[model samples]
Target chain A: MNKLPDALPVEKAAISDLARQTLHGTVDEATNARGRERMISAARAGASKSNGTQRRRRITRASVLLFAAAALAVSLVIWWPRAPLTFVTTGGEVTSTHDGGVRVATRDAESVTRFSDGSVVTFGVQSAGRLEGVRTNGARVVLTSGELHLDITHRKDTAWSIEAGPYVVRVTGTAFDVAWSPSEGAFVVAMRQGSVVVEGPLTPAGVSLRAGQHLVVARDGVMRMGEGTPPTLAELAVASSDAVALVSSAAPVVVSRAPSAPAEAPPSSSVPAIATSVAPSDRPASFAKLVAEGRYAQVVTAARGRGLEWVAESASLEELVALADAARYEKDGTLARAALEAERKRFATTQAGRNATFLLGRLAEDSDGNTARAIVLYDEYLQTGGPFSAEALGRKMLAVRKTRGDAGAEPIARAYLEKYPKGVYAAAARSIVGTP
Target chain B: MPLTVAARKVVPVVRWQTPAELVQALLAAEPEAHGVLWDRYSTSLRAVLRRSLGPDTEVEDALQEVFIRFFRALPTLREPAALGSFLFGIAVHVARGLLRKRRIRRWFRLTDDGEIPEPPDDVDPVSEQAQAAVRRLYVILDDLDDESRLVFVLRHIEGLEITELAACLKMSPATVKRRLARVTPLVFARARNDADLASFMAAPDQGERS
Candidate 1:
């Protein structure tokens, strides 16, 4: 960690908290206002005394001696080490300093130092460059030296972006730092705000960065996005597989597992247009249309054609069977059972298929009240690398509990808590287990 | 020429002092001079303080300290109109000092009666939970250092200006600009993470049989 200069002992946490408290009305106003009034008045009076004499003297003494003497005094004052510059902020004060650093303080607010190699920094309240708002959205400082500091207050849902060097920082509304090192020929972006995506170099295209995350771009344009612990092998594997599965299920067809092929394959032609237009209201209408038209063959064909693929829509196997039965006016229990078994088999083979199976299981529970069968389907969906692993486990626990009462719920919840401590629905499981 | 010289001689040396100079004089035992000085720059100073301290804090207390400190350090000040900057500086110090004291008290869990409890250094279950919470919070705040955070809070939260901030802190305007550049994104990252967390938690479960 980099240590700040000793003169600047104020912690950022303390400052932020103070700012928050002051904004929230926890600080007193009347007394501070009066005190400020007195201080400024005194300073101005003194200024008039010093500058006033020079003005009056100039008027009286057109004489060379007095004129020369006045000019000399002015020069001396300007050259003086302690010559003060007027600092102002609408509601805060400039506080602390570091080598090549400064702050602007005003009542209830302060603007700290931002770096600029050769660029200018600008600030305005509310609207960008609209100095009228009581509070500023964020300050924009142009970087000339390839580095600038921007500390902004978080406005709900409002984001501030910084364009520095070859990078653009999309802020989520918190305080963070960005530095562009000309010597290194790369920009280093750090979050002070919530988080930011340091997009630049256009090499690998867009990159998303989170809080406590930093990235370094080499002069050769190689960008590595971490300084501390790099992504673990397990994490990378999970992310890769999840991405592949999610894309395969959402897209029309499952692209081959070819290493040379791009992660996102071109859309497949066989995937029906219905998958593309899978909206909430459209789900029931499409299902009804399929049933009315006796399109069981087409539904099964479509489902089979997109083998080992995930469909984000509600056109699962169970929904197809319901549509077929509604159209044919016949309930074939053997066919229904066969279709479900086939769906389960397909789901077990791939992550996307598993997600589809889970969706089908959920549809069955909703439409057919087959709780026992749904529980079995959910268990298969919870296998390793299952797309709905967390959801499947949660539903299984709920199903068992409902059938066997509270006694059965506790053990399932405990088992879930033990297996996946940070799993989705872990909190609910913990609640069931009576643990915090 | 003679009349001009006479006028110059009679003008009683025309001792004009800058606001800063008058402030210094008032602080240096000339309490009587303080009133005149106060009458001149009180409103401007108050505006600066109100903006700096924000409308939320006891602005009056901070303002009072500005005056007291102004008086106490008047002798050391060489420039007078820089009085605005000087007073602004004093205000910043006072605010930071108060905040530091508050943080220290909170960190130590100090009691109102001035008793300090033993700092919890052990990693017990309760402490571990607390540490985890603290860790998460810091993970949110860690992207920023102290200076960047202050700059962010003062400008964005308190809404201060480059010129005023530069004057108060006795720094160049450029420095404030650079600091702000670095601080904005850190704030944004934390907010984004929060939204993501909320969405993830709200996702519907597929296994739920209702």
Candidate 2:
């Protein structure tokens, strides 16, 4: 092979010598040592692999034996019988039964039972309940009358149940209020936080309830599930407290009333200030108040209670933006996008409308992973010179880099650096341009 | 030919004067032969890798791969004296594979289209300007197909003759000359158009050492 000497062709010499000079780096002694060590390690690995067949066979046999031993040990630990959890009651009288059960009866005051697993069950005044059985994992309680508030600590092995008349509420880890009237045959469950599954005679398959939900079953098999925060107890006591109803006061769909059982009805007057349903005349202030209070989940639920898409379309501009912000905080990307699009449509050429375009771009890029659409929307918003111009420009440059590579994004990056030299994306822009 | 060495570490102070001697020692599994082999050819191999895969790319990994392939294919080598050529062929093959993978990765925007490394603090200002021009030249080369890019790199940056490129690339001499002829003007045109490289292109002597 001929070594092309200095008599090389002019075209070859132009870039050739320049590239050679630029890449003229030498491997130092430390680098050579590292390379030698890597090769030696690789050589040792290859040599060991020559006898890998027998070694692998031995490993396989040992692994099987070890796995079998481990499985047996795990089985022994799992199937072993454990002692049941015990508890003591306070502020009430408990009558112990022969079958390791206790009956909690409160005459003039409430009763609070503390369990070993960090669970608390508060029985209301004049209430009667029974702990039928207690086990290592959980216990079963039957509320004969009045109300009971439960705050069950979350554990992986938890299993608790509360039976109110024919309805059985199963709980793993949650807090809720349950009331039952034997004579009235009415049951009500209002979830404060977490979730529970209720199985009943009306519908045997059971209905699941999440936080911020109220369920009531009348004697005539009429079921009503409403969207509102349940009534809060001032002291978890029946004395000095009014009847707190769980039904929504705004649009309470009362199909049938079972003879006005005051003890079983969660009063509307005691509803927490945040969960209070404002009258229809006060809804505009209610929307703003709900957003200011950071009740995003309640806002989403209330918006959906009314036709959400309709509210997005015909609601006032402020209401629409509030709904969009609420849905975004709630992580309901679809609803957030809908409200943003509606804001842009109804209030086009306004500052909020232009700002909606930038938010929609964020949703498109982050939530929907549509880089091309995000770039288009960002470009539209950038053309408007809106409040989010800097942020939108930075996002657009990154989105372009994601889809079109550094070469495609360099012009935008350069523009961004020129305008905002000390901006947030300055470091990233310098990286793309290979500048300091 | 069942060649086997006894299970013992052989760390001999053997100086391999020729490729034939190194290959013989390596085949015999002399542990010291690997280091000696690396000492003899590592510098040129590094240069070749740096030039072919750009300076910012993983040249160390490619260099290790070249030696590993050489070790793996040593048994099949028919002529011991042609070790250098055999290794060069393997380096070209590895470089071609990386170039193809790099193209696919670039299409997916998975990798940056390589940047010019920072010049040393002691580098002259003129050399720094040339480095920027080199960066632009690499960006243009990134647009070429893998085979064409390899042909250009081997012929020009590596200073290989047409016949040597043909041998290294497993192409005919006419094909090498044809690719070189086709790629030269295209590269020069791109360099002339590039603002950073125009100065280097206008005076070509601007890149020369004093």
Candidate 3:
């Protein structure tokens, strides 16, 4: 068997996603109407071509045609069994238990498993999972405990699922990591690339984890998709064997660095994003330093291993902002959003929280592409009237234009220009308002 | 912009909620289905055009051609769920045809605008260098026979699986590979010499033969 080599430029590996954005921006109203017109003409031409055949078969019964179509469908389904996903390889201390579970334990070293579907799953030290069924459209595997990483090749329609106790992380094609421990009693999933839909018996509802997001769920039924990082091994194991006891009332604390460089911010301290759940004495500073150094992937991995349950309690709001900035540079929206959410929730009355709210509103509009949600968040954040007021107004108007009809959007466009005469979005506002 | 206030306030019109339902509507020759199709998949379909055809290729004309063909071929589509993939299949041929025509036009000394693009003022050296490398890559692609170049583009740029490529080109996977191999070295060896693109040849994928 032969395979094609990696022929694309490294940067162009994600060209398809970028191309989609390009198309969205480039396909104007004229192009859309033109394409639609062309399609209508082609369909009309097709119908005309088939008209003579229908006229010639005027005696044919509609009932006979319907019967033939149904019969063909039935025959095809009965004869064909969709191709099954088969295993390619596995590793770690594997044992087939009496309960019909293949227990895989990585005592010290990591174990790598590959599938014929071109998907790879790696288990970190002390981790374990059980082998499960691999069906045609997807596969089911149970993570008994500990950490595991997955790299899945993009598949059309088919989904691969990994079950960890009460939660299931389902993915079509993506790269991500998961950590679950019975003692810790939390199911954590981190997305590196692509997206996954996570739902479980204990979860309130299915929460989607886009690339750069993390989901944390405690055994006590407390779950949040964007509030904190993962818990550490020390928190899960050392302090107690009972995972439920480890559940902290306050969300996980994180100190994030701001953009433009952590050094620019005075005193170089990270802000307290979350309420101190685990209270790691020194980790927050080091974490902030990592973020400042633009080592976002490292920070995420560290949080997963140590359990994001801990952060320096003394971290300042400025430092938290920096940490979030670094996370954004790494394209980790979930982590960034989590930090911002914590800041908004914990320090609501402060200027820091106000800024966080504005940033969150922007993220909701730009990254999430939720125009309706953005409008609400922006409207609320604007009440704070902080440094980002001008920027926020421009973005809010853009969101408004998306939601409002062209005639209705005119007012918002006019309002935006009047507020900021030479604003960032002046040109855009002009186009929307049709101002000379 | 979203639907106007009046339209939203009006009795909520029943609409096709799923791809299957939309396909059914199109099959029935409902005119609204055309708008639905364009709104839903045009962005991705346009991307297919850019990847199959070059980025600079004037896709407005090609895009119109694709939509026309798409409507003509809708009745022949066996799987409604795979509408996106079906569009991709159509795009491969349309782009190939366009590429061939462009090559012929080039050969016949079609009037050239001679419009040269000026470099941006605030250029990132790394990005500029990469763009140049891509330009060189495509220039090499233009020199290859149409069949070989098409295979290379489909395999590399479009990221089509071998089986998918076979179905679209109406050729066996072996033949696709043979045609691809005819010009693979031209790109690989050239990239090997370019500092900016040399790493692409660092190590071939597992099962890939030189």
Taking the candidates in order, what DockQ does each have?
A: 0.04, 0.20, 0.07
TM-score order of candidates, top first: 2, 3, 1
lDDT of each: 0.46, 0.71, 0.62
On the 0 to 100 scale, the lDDT of residue A90 in model 2 is 85
Model 1: per-residue Cα lDDT over A1-436, one tens digit each? 1222222212333333333332332123464345535555555565555467668778777677877998999998866564221223332233334322233322322233332221123232211111111112333233322334455545553445565444556555555555544334444554433566554423111345666555544343333445333332222333443342332222211111111121332233433434533565555556545433433433433434433233223346445433333322223333434444444454445433455466556655655788887787787666543324555687778787778765778887888776555555678788777789
Ranking of candidates on DockQ, top first: 2, 3, 1
Candidate 3: C-alpha lDDT: 0.62
Candidate 3, A85-139: lDDT as tens digits: 6654456788774644356788888877777778887888899886566677666
How far is A317's C-alpha from truth in model 1 (Å)? 87
Q: Could you say which candidate leads in TM-score?
A: 2
- Candidate 1's residue-wise lDDT over B43-140, tens digit each? 44444444343332335555556676666566678876566566656766776565555456656876423665344354457435323433343345
Instruction: Order candidates by lDDT, high to low.
Output: 2, 3, 1
**Which ranges in model 1 have alpha carbons more than 4 Å from their true place?**
A1-436, B1-21, B24-32, B36-59, B110-146, B157-178, B188-210
Off by over 4 Å in 2: A1-11, A50-436, B1-14, B112-126, B206-210
Question: Per-residue lDDT for B93 in model 3?
Answer: 83
Report lDDT (Cα) of residue A144, candidate 3.
69
Candidate 2 local accuracy as lDDT?
Answer: 0.71
What TM-score does chain A reach in every model? 0.26, 0.40, 0.36
